[model samples]
Target: MDRFIECWNGLDDPRTGNAALHDFHEILAIAMCAVLCGGQGSVDMGLFAKSKEPFLRGFLRLENGVPSHDTFSRLFRMLDTEQFRAAFQRFMAGFSEQCEGVVAIDGKVLRRSFDSASGKSPLHMVAAWGCEQRLVLAQIATDAKSNEITAVPKLLEMLRLKGTIVTADALNCQRAIAQQIVDQGGDYALALKGNQGTLHDDVVLFLDDPASKAITAEPVVEADHGRIETRTATVATDIAWLNKDHHWPGLAAVGKVERLRETAGKTTSQTAYYLLSAPLTPERFNEVVRSHWGVENRLHWRLDVVMNEDQDRSRLGNGPHNLAVLRHMAINVMQKDGEKGSLRGKFKRASWDEAYLARLLSLF
Candidate 1:
């Protein structure tokens, strides 16, 4: 809590005048706590504050009592989003482990946050997920997925990625983005597609060529959910001949992964190519590829299904983005809580058991 207070105080409060009653720290703390207890928007946060007044008072003074839902909404609307994100990055620095494994960068949309009258599309957020630690290190908001190509560089600048492997989809396969990762002392494994025109075609041609075969590892197979899948990964490091035509910065090697799947009497095969900065074995490349999906299945899916992020109707000002930050904080705390039950169960315990809630929040 002290660390949180420090981060909060570091922010330049956008509010002025005698009209303000609730402390900024108080509102932020209340919102975070409430969300951890399964509270959704400002109304739910206000109610949670009222119910947990005594528990809140244990750490906060609450000189003017709890703020109303309107107060919560208005303050967040005017809050400085960049400052809020910086503060979150500072606060999370305490809990982030050494960033060594795959750090997957992905984007998600706040579906219900669109405002038709104002001509505002849904908010798209790009997040950095630590696959090994199961933590959301940082996030940035963009207007669309195309904007992610630009947002990814800024987002990468906010995180400590030295000695880490960054993975992204085909949308982020830009040469500049890959160069940015390398410049930061980090390695990249970016997905390749026809978006790069001849570069993609050349790699596909090389991997398909019988003479270019320089196999590094064996294929991995899996069977589950009434389906059997096979993945064969190979790395080609001798790109000197190809480099004469397309000069990619820090391009150590190119990778190819072939997937074969059979389910319900249907069989399909697909091949994916990647640009690599790390000289990885086929086995390691396969692991990194699989870990990239963790951001989708673990973070995005959980937010939509368990945290109900897409259903949230808080699009005013900073409300949607700020609330999303709170959700990320709540998830980090809950995941670190070491509870044997599911996330929904943790929310239930936090709501029903103040002592349990205290224990959970303390982990933050």
Candidate 2:
């Protein structure tokens, strides 16, 4: 808690002299606590502050006696987004251990944040997900005109990914991005699709050719939730035979994964390829590639389903972006909480049990 407070203190106060009645740190503390306990909007935050006044007073001065819902909305809108994002990263750094497993980078849209008056579309945020820990490491907001490609480098620049394996979808499979990962002391496992024109064709031809000497692995089979699935991954490390015309930076090998699924007597099959900088075995390559989906499942899905982020309607100024950060922080807090049943269950407990809320806050 002390470390988080210190980090929050580092943010530049957005208010002018004497214009602020409430302490900036206290406001954020209340806001974060509210979100951790499943408060969705500014009104919910205000109500939470009022209901938990005693518990809040124990730590916070509450000098102004819990700012109004309007105050909460205004403060969040007035907050400097870049500084707030940096502070969030710094705050999360205290809890982040050494990153070593698969780190997947992806983007999500705040669906209802578009403002017709301001002529703004929905906000697009690129997030980095820690697959093994099931945690969100960092995020950045991108403009509607631009895509994740531009925002990805900025997000990568903010993270410390030494010894970690980073993965991304085909949109991010650029030569410069590959080089950036390797330059940052990390390895890349980027998906290869039609975007890479000739390179994609070459990979497909190489994998399909029976005469080609490629390393192959036995198919992995699984049965779960009334479905039977089988996956087979193949890696071709010997890429020197390819034409020298298309030179990919840090490219060590190419891989292909075939998925066959059956349900209710129906069957389907699909194949996907990847460009890898890490010299992983065929099996490990499959594992790393499969782990990339954790970003969609663990982070994006949870935010929409569990936290109701998609249904949230806070679209003014920095409200959408800042609230997204708060939601990320809440997820991290609940995930760190020991003896958790479900995320929703933990949130309910935090709301009703002050002791549990205190324990959650203690994780700092």
| Among all candidates shown, the one with the greatest TM-score | 2
Lowest lDDT sum, 10 consecutive residues, model 2, at 1-10
* Residue-wise C-alpha lDDT for candidate 1, range 121-223, written one tens digit per residue: 8889999999998989999998777788889999999887899999999999998988888899999999999998999999999988879955657778999
RMSD of each: 1.6, 1.5
Give the Cα-based TM-score of candidate 1 against the true structure.
0.95
Q: What is the C-alpha lDDT of each candidate?
A: 0.87, 0.87
Candidate 2, residue 329: how far the Cα is off, in Å = 1.0
Provide backbone clash counts, one per model.
0, 0
Steric clash pairs (candidate 1): none
Weakest lDDT window of 10 consecutive positions for candidate 1: 1-10
lDDT of 2 by residue, 72-122 (tens): 898888888898898888778777856768999999998998999989899
- Score every model by TM-score: 0.95, 0.96
lDDT of 2 at 263: 97
